[model samples]
Target chain A: MIEARGLTKRYGDLVAVNDVSFEVGSGEVVGFLGPNGAGKTTTMRILTGFVPATDGTAKIAGHDIFEDPLAARRAIGYLPETPPLYPEMDVAHYLTYVARLKDVPRGRRKGAVDRAMERCGLADVRRRVIGSLSKGYRQRVGLAQAIVHDPAVLILDEPTVGLDPIQIREIRGLIAGLADSQEGGTGHTVILSTHILAEVEAICRRVMLINAGRKVLDGPLAELTRDGQRLEDVFTRVTLSDQAEASAGGTAEAAEAAQ
Target chain B: MRHVGAIAGRELRSMFVSPVAYAILTLFAIVAGFFFLASVLGFDAQVAEAQQFRAFDYLRQLNLNDHVIAPFYGIMWIVLLFLVPGITMGLFASEKTNGTQELLMTSPITIWELVIGKFLAASLFVLLLVGMVGIFTGILFFFGDPELPKAASGLLGLTLVALSYVAVGSFASSVTRNQLIAFFLSLVLLLILWMLSIVADLGAGGGAIASDGLVSRSMRWLSSADRFEQMVRGLVDTKDLAYFGFMIGTFLILTKASIESVRWR
Candidate 1:
C-alpha cells in the first residue's frame, strides 16, 4: 500500500505539487489522471523516492519514503516518463542488468528475465540491441525492466505515450493480464499516470484526477462515471469549476477594493 | 557494492557497443602515435649527431644517467589530456539528452551508487586507453636502456591524471545535456589548472611577492600536471594523492547532488 498526506513539492517560488494527498491499497489498480505539467510526474517521483517532498510525507508499503527509502523503493517498480535504456545493450543483456540492479536473486535472475520478456511480448527481440528497436519495442523493454523484480507496487508514468494504436492495445492487455494473473491471485497494486482518459476508463478500477497540482476528484471509476457522465465530462466539469472559483475570488477581491 | 558493480558493468558494456567509444579510441591512438614517433625520432637523431664529437662523448659520459623514459612521461601526459575528456563527456550528458536520466533517478539505487558507478566505468575506459600506451612504451625496452621504475611511476601518474580528468568530465556532463558543452567545460577547467602551474612558475621567478604567492601555490597544488610530474620522478607524495582523491570525491558528490536536485525541479 502507498499513502501520501499533504504532499507538496516546490521549485523556487512555484509549487509543483500543492498539498495533494491520496492512497492506493494492495490489489488495486489506480489511474492517475492529470494534464501535462499538472504535478503528476512530480507526485510519482516523490512516491518512488526519486525526489523528496518539500512538506508532508509519503509512505510505501508501511515504510516512510523519506525515512526508509531503500525499503520503500524495494517494494515499488517505477517507469518514469521516458524509458531508461542503454541503447548499446541488447534487450536480454539490459534486462539482466536491471534484474541484478533490482536485487533479483542470482539463482532466479534468468527466470525473472525470461518471465518479464515473455509477459511484455519481448521474447523475440531479446537478442536485438535496444537502439535498433523501434519506440514501441523500447517501451516494451522498459515495461519488462520495471516488472522484472516483481515489485508489489508498480508506478508507471505515461507508459502509453507515443505508441501506435495496436501497440497501445497490446500494452494495455499486458497490464490487464499482469493485474489479473492467477499466480499471485491478488494482482499487483498499480498506479499509472496518463493523459489518456479512455484507457483509464477502460482498465482502471479507481481514478484520481488532479488539476493545477491539486486533487479535484477521487473515487471509483464506475461510480464517478455514473449518471451517464463520460470521464471527459467529469474531468472538464471539475477543472472548470476550479477555474470558475478562482476567477470569482478575483472579482470579489476587485469589488472589495472598489468599496 | 553489488549495485555499483552492476551499474559499472552495464556502463562499460555500453561504451564498447557504442560507436563513440571506438571513435575516441581511434582518434587518441592515431594522434598519440604520431606524437610519440616524432618525439622519439627527433631525440634519436639529435643523440646520433652529437655522438660524433669528442666533447659530446665526454658530455654523454657525464650524463650517462640521463633517462630516455622521462620524455615518454611528457608524451603520456599529452595523450591523457586529449583522450580522457572524450571518454567521460557523454557519461551523464547522453543520459540527459536521451531523457534516460529520469528513468535512472526513479530507480531504487541511491545517488552515490549511480555517481560512483559512472565514475569507475569512465576511469576504467581511461585506464584501458593508458594500458594500450603502456604496451607501446614496452617497445622502448628493446630499443634502449629504459628505467622500469620510472616508467611504472609515469604510468601511475597517468592513471591519477586520468582519474582527475574523468571526475571533472563527469561533473561537466552532469551539468549539461550537450556533449560538446560537457567536453568544452572539462577541457577549459583542466586547461585553466594546467596554465595556473605555468603562471606559478613565472611568479616564483620574481614576478610576484612571496606573501601573495599562496594563490599561485594553491592553484599549482590543484593541477593534475604538477602531480603527474612528481609521480614521474618516483615520488608518490601523500599530498598529490590527497589532491586527486579530493577532486574525484568532489565531482562525484556534485554529480549525486545534481541528480538529486532534478527531482525537486
Candidate 2:
C-alpha cells in the first residue's frame, strides 16, 4: 500500500535521498535497513508527508503525498525516530489528542485509545506523565500512538531504538502480530527502519536496504540470506561494497556525501 | 473547524500542564493589580485636591475615563507586550525542540488548522488577562462612573491588539526551534509593532480616523497603539477594526508560510 517512485530529497548540494524507489503491498512488513546518514529517515519523512521530496513523488494507499497530503496522511500512522511525544502529557490523554488529530470518530476515540494502550501493554501507566515513564514504556507509548487510529499504513523509523532487549522483543512481537493478525481479515502494511539486523529477521517479511540515498538491495528476507548465509555479512557486503569501490577509485563522494 | 478545535484544546491543556501558564498568570496579576491600584489612587489624589481648592465645576467635569480607565488600559497593553511573548514562544518552537511537531505534521490536519489552533489558544490565554482588567473596570463602576461603552470598546481594542500580538508571536515562534530566540524575536516584533502604531498615534494627533492627508491616512494604517487609543476615547470606527483585521491576517499567512517552508527545508 506504499508506492515511492524516484523519491529524491536534496538539501542544497547534498542529495539525502537520491531517486530511491520501492513499493510495499498490503499486509507486507518491510524492514528498511541503512547505516547512519544513509537517508533512511529522510525517505521515511518524505513518505509520511513530514517533508516534501525534492524531485519525485510518493503515494500511501493510492493517495499522492504532494497533491492530496491530507488524505494521503489520513491513511498513514507515522512514528518518527524520536517518537514525537509530549513530556508533560499523560499516556491516555496524549493518545486521545492524537486520535482527535487522526480524525478517529468521537464516539470511538476512547475505545481507540484504550485498544492502542491495550495492544502496547500500557494500561497501568495510562495516567502517568510521559516524562515519568521508563525508556521501555516511552517506546511503548510511541508504538501506541502509531496504532491509535488504526490507519491502513504504518511508517515507523527505528521503532525499537534505545529500548532494552526485553522491550525490543515485546515491540517485535507486537509488530509481528500487526503483520499476521486477522484483526479485520487483513493485516496492516508496515515499513520499519532499523539498524539492528536481527530486528528484520524477528518481525519483517521483506527487506529493503539503501546506502547513500540509493536503494542497494530490495528482496525477500529468506532469499536474500539463503544457504545458511547470515544477514549481517550480506548487509555489509551490499552496503560497504560501494564504499570499497569509491575509496579504491579515490572518488571524493566515498562516504562524506551521506554525512 | 473540528481539527482546529482539537489542536487548540491540546495547546491550552499543555500550557496548563506546564508551569509557564501559572507563572505568567501570577506575573500578570501582580503587575496588573499594582497598576490598577496606582491609577485609582492617583485619581483619588486628584479628586481630593480639586475638592480642597473648591473647584466644584472642574470636579464635576472630571471623568474616570481620562484619569483612570484609559491610562489603566494603556498600562495593560504594555503589560501584554512583555507577557505575550511568554505565551507564544512555546507555541511552535517547543514542538520543534521536543520533536512533537512531527506528530502534527504527519496528521490529517491542514497547515491552517495547526496555525489557527495555536493562535486561538494564545488569544484565549491573553483574554483571561483582559478578563482580569474587566474585574478592575468593574470596581471602578462600584464607586464611580466609567462610561460603559468606552470601557467595552477599550476591552475590544485590547482583545484586537492581543490578537495581533498572538499572530506576530506565532509567526516568530514558527521561524525558530529555540524558545529563547522565539520569545525575544516576538518581543522585539511586538514592541516594534506597538511603537510604530504609537508613531501613527502621534502623527494623527490621536484623533478619530484622522485621514485629513495621505500621511495621516498611512499613519492611521500603521497605528496599532493608536487603535487602542481611539477605542479608549469610546470610538470604535471601522478604520481601527479594519487595521486589526489586516494585521492578524497578514501575520497568520506569514506564519503558515514559515511552517510550510520548514517542510521544504
Candidate 3:
C-alpha cells in the first residue's frame, strides 16, 4: 500500500536521508527500526507527503506523492513526530476539524470523529481541552486524528513514545486491534517507526532496519532471529556495521574531493 | 471550497478561544472609541463656533464625512496597523512552533487553500472588530445625521485596509516560528508601506521630475493609506480597487510560496 523508490532528502550539504527504498503491503504491520537520525522520520515524512524528497519517488495507495499529492495524502493517516494539535481546541472539536480536513463527507464527518474517538479510547474526555490533557491522552488524540479519515495506510512516528507502561500497552493493543480487525475486511497497512525493539516484537511482524539513512536489513521478524540471535543483537550488528562503513566512506570521499 | 471553509472555521474558532483575540478586540475598541469621541466633540465645537459667528458657509466645512468620519477612519487605519499584527502573528508561526505545520502540510489541503483560509479568517475577525466600532457610528444615526453611503464606503475602505494589513502580516508569519518576530516583521513592513507616500512627497525626488514623478507616483500608488483616503472620499476607482486586490493577491501568493518552501527545507 506504501512504496518508496530511491528516496533521498538533503538539507544543503547534510544528507538527511540517503538513497533508500521500502514497501508495505496492505494489512501488514511493518516496524521501521532505526537509530536516532537514521532517516526513519524523513522516510515516513516523504511517504506522508509532509516533505518532498530531494530525489526519488514515493507512492501511497498507487498515487505518486509528488505528482498527485492530494490523492496520495488522502490514503495516508499520519502521526508526525509531534502530534499536530491546537492547544485551545477540545478533543472532539479537534477530531471533527481533522475529519473535515481529511475530506470526510459532511454527512459522515460526525460518525468518523465519533468512531475514531471510541477506537482511541478518547470518548470519556471528548469535551476536554487538548492543552490540558495528559501526554498519553494527547498521543491518543493524535492517533485518533490520524485514523479519523479511515485512510488505507497509517504512518506513525513514535506513537508510543513518552507514554507510561499502561498507556503504551493500550496504544499497542489499539494498533494490534487495527490489524486483527483488518483480517475480516479489506484491512489496513501500518508503518510504525520506533527505536524500541519491544515495540517491534509486540505488534510488528516485519522489521525494516535502517542505518545512516540506508536500508541495512528488511525481513520478517521470525527470519531475523532464526539463528538464536536476539533482535537486539541483530539491530546492534546491522546499525554499527553501517556506522563504521559510513565513516570509512566519508573519509574516502573527502580524500577524493581534496585530491 | 469546503476545504477552505473547514480550515477557516477551525482557525477562527482557535483564535476566538485564545486570549489574544479578546485582547486585540478590547484594546482596539478603547482606542477607537476615544478617537471617535474626540472627533465628534471636535465637530461639535466647530459647529458651535460657526453658529456663534452666524456663518452658514462655515457649517458646510463641518460636514460629518470630512470633519468626523474621515478622521475617525484615519484613526482606525492607524489602529489597524498596530492591532492587526496581533491577529496574524500566530497564523503560521504558531503552527510551526507547535509542530502542527507538519500535520497541516501533510493534509490534502493545498498551500494556497491554507493561506487563503487563514487570511480570510483574520479578515473576518477584523470585520467583526469594525462592526463593533460601527456601534459608535450607530450613535450618529440616533442623535445626528451622517451620510449613510459615505459612512458605509469608509467602512469598506477600512476593511480593505485591514485586509491589506492581514495579507502582509500573514506573509511575515509564514517566514518564522516566533510570534514576536512575526509581529515585528509585519509591523515594520506595514510601516514602510504606510510612510512611503509621505516620505516621497517630502523629498526632492518627489517633485523634481514632474507632478507625476515616477518615485512619488509609484509610492503613492503602493501606499495603502493613499488609496484608502481616496476610498473614504466615496470614489471607488478601479485603479484603487485593483491596487488592493493586487496587493492582497501578491502577498497571499508569497505566503503560499513561503509555506511550500518549508517542504524543501
Candidate 4:
C-alpha cells in the first residue's frame, strides 16, 4: 500500500504540490491525471522518495518515505518523468547492474535480470548498447530496470510519453499484464501518471484529477465519468471550468471598475 | 557496503565499456611515459658524468635528486588533473542530465552509499592510472639505482591526491547536470586549491595583504602541493595524511548533502 498525507512541494515562491493526500491499496491500479504543470510529477517524486515533501508524510508499504526512506524505497519501483538510463551500457549489462544495485540476492541476480529482460521484450536487443537503441526500446529498458527487483509498488511517470502507437499499446499491455500476473504479482499497487485520458480509462480502475497543484476530483474512472461521458469531457469540465471562472471573475472586476 | 560495491561495479563496467576510459588511459600513458623517460635519461646522463669525476664531485652532482623526483610528481599531477575530471565529471552529471538520478534516488540506498560508491568507482580508475605509472617506475628500476622509498612515497602521494580530486570532482558533478560545467567547476576548484599556497606565500611576503590571515595559513595546510612534497620526501606525517583524509571526507559529505537537498526541490 502507498499512503500520502498533506504532501506538499514548493519551489521558491511557486507551490508545485499543495496539501495532496491519497492512498492506493494492494492490487489497485491508480491513474494520476493532470494538465501540464499540475504537480503530478512532483507528487510521484515524493512518493518514490526522489524528492522530499516540504511539510507532509508519505508511506510506501508501511515505511515512511522520509523517516525510513531506504525501507520505503525498497518496497517501491519507480520510473521518473524521463526514463533513467546510462546510454553507454548495453541492455543486458544495464539491467543486470540495476538488478544487483536493487539488492536482488546474488544467487537470484542473473535470473532476475533475465526475467526483467524477457518480460520487457528486450531479450532480442540484450546485446545492443542502450545509446544506440530506438526510443521505444530505451523506454522498455527503463521499464525493465524499474521492475528488476519486483517491488510491491510501481510508480511510473509518463511511461508512454514518447512511444509510437504500437509501442504505446505494447507498453500499456505490459503494465496491465504485470499488474495482474500471478508470478509477477506482489498484488503490486501501481500509480501511473499520464495526460493521455484514453490510456487511463483503459488501464486505471481509480483516477485522481489534479489541477493547479490541487486535487479537484478523485474516484473510480467509471463513476467519475458517469452517463457514458468521455474521460476527456470530464477532464475538460474540471480544468476549463476553473479557467473560465477566473476569466469571468476578471471581467466582473473590470465592469465594476468601469461603472 | 554491498550497495556501494554494486554501484562501484556498475560504474567501473561503464567506464570500461565507453571509449572515454580508453581515451583517458591512452592519454595518461603517453604523457606520463614521456615525462618519466625524459627524467630518467637526464638523471642517467648526470650520474654517468658524476662517475667519471672524483667521489667528492659525485656527492655534489647528486643534487639532481630533487630534480628527478620533482618531474615525476609534476607529470603525475598534470595527468591526474586532466583525468580525474574525465572520470568524475559524468558520475552525477550524466545521472541528472539523462534522468537516471531519479531512478537511483528512488532506489533503496542511502546518500552515503551512493557517494562512496561513486567515489570508489572513480578512485578505482585513478588506481589504474597510478598502476600504469608504477609500471613505468618499475622500468626505471631496470636502468640505474632508483630510490625505492622515494618512488613508493611518490605513488602514495599520487593516490592521496587522486582521492582528494575524485571526492571534489564527485561533489562538483552532483551540483550540476552539465558535464562540461562539472568538469570546469572541478578544475577551477582544484586550481584554486593548488594555487592557495602560492597566494599565501605572496601574502606573507607583503605582495598582498592577507584579508583573512588565518585562512591563508589554513590554505597552506590544504595545499596538495605541500602534502605531496612532504610525501615525496619520504616523510609520512600523520597530520598530512589527516589533511588529505579531511579533504576527501569533506567533499564526500558535501556530495551526500547536495544530493539530499534535491529532495526539497
- For model 3, residues B56-136, the per-residue Cα lDDT tens digits are 988876788888888998888898898899899999999998888888888889887899899999999989888876788
Expressed as tens digits, the lDDT of each residue in A159-193 for candidate 4 is 99988999999999989987885764465789999
lDDT of 2 by residue, B1-265 (tens): 6799998999999999888899998988899899999998998998999999999998987789888999999999988988899899999999998889999999999899999999999999999988998898899998987889989998899889988999999999999999999999999988876676556556567664464677665655675876788898899999789989999999999999999999877
- For model 3, the stretches where C-alpha displacement exceeds 4 angstroms are A250-259, B205-211
Clashing pairs in 2: none
Proportion of native contacts found in each model? 0.67, 1.00, 0.91, 0.88
Candidate 4 error regions (>4 Å): A181-186, A245-259, B48-67, B207-216
Q: Alpha-carbon error at B4 in model 4, in Å?
A: 0.6
Structural similarity to truth (TM-score) of each candidate: 0.94, 0.94, 0.96, 0.93
- How do the residues B103-189 of candidate 4 rate in per-residue lDDT, one tens digit apiece? 788878777888999999999999999898888778766655567888788778888998999999999999999999999999999
**Best of the two (1, 4) by lDDT:** 4
TM-score of candidate 2 versus the correct structure, residues matched by position: 0.94
Model 4 misses residue B35 by how many Å?
0.9
Grade the docking of candidate 2: high
Candidates, DockQ: 0.65, 0.83, 0.84, 0.76
Question: Which one wins on TM-score?
Answer: 3
| lDDT for each residue of candidate 1 in B1-265, tens digit (9 for 90 to 100) | 6688988887888888888889888887787677667667766666666775645764464321134455666776776776677888888889888766765665667778888899999988988888877877787777766667767877787788888889888988888889999888888887887787777777777768452567876867776777788887778889888888898888788877876666665
Best model per DockQ: 3
Looking at model 3, residue B161 earns an lDDT score of 87
Please give, for every candidate in the order listed, the TM-score of chain B alone compared with the true chain B.
0.90, 0.92, 0.95, 0.92
**Order of all candidates by lDDT, from best down to worst?**
2, 3, 4, 1
Q: Write one digit per residue (lDDT tens) for candidate 3, span A128-182.
A: 9999999999999999999999999999999999999999999999988777655
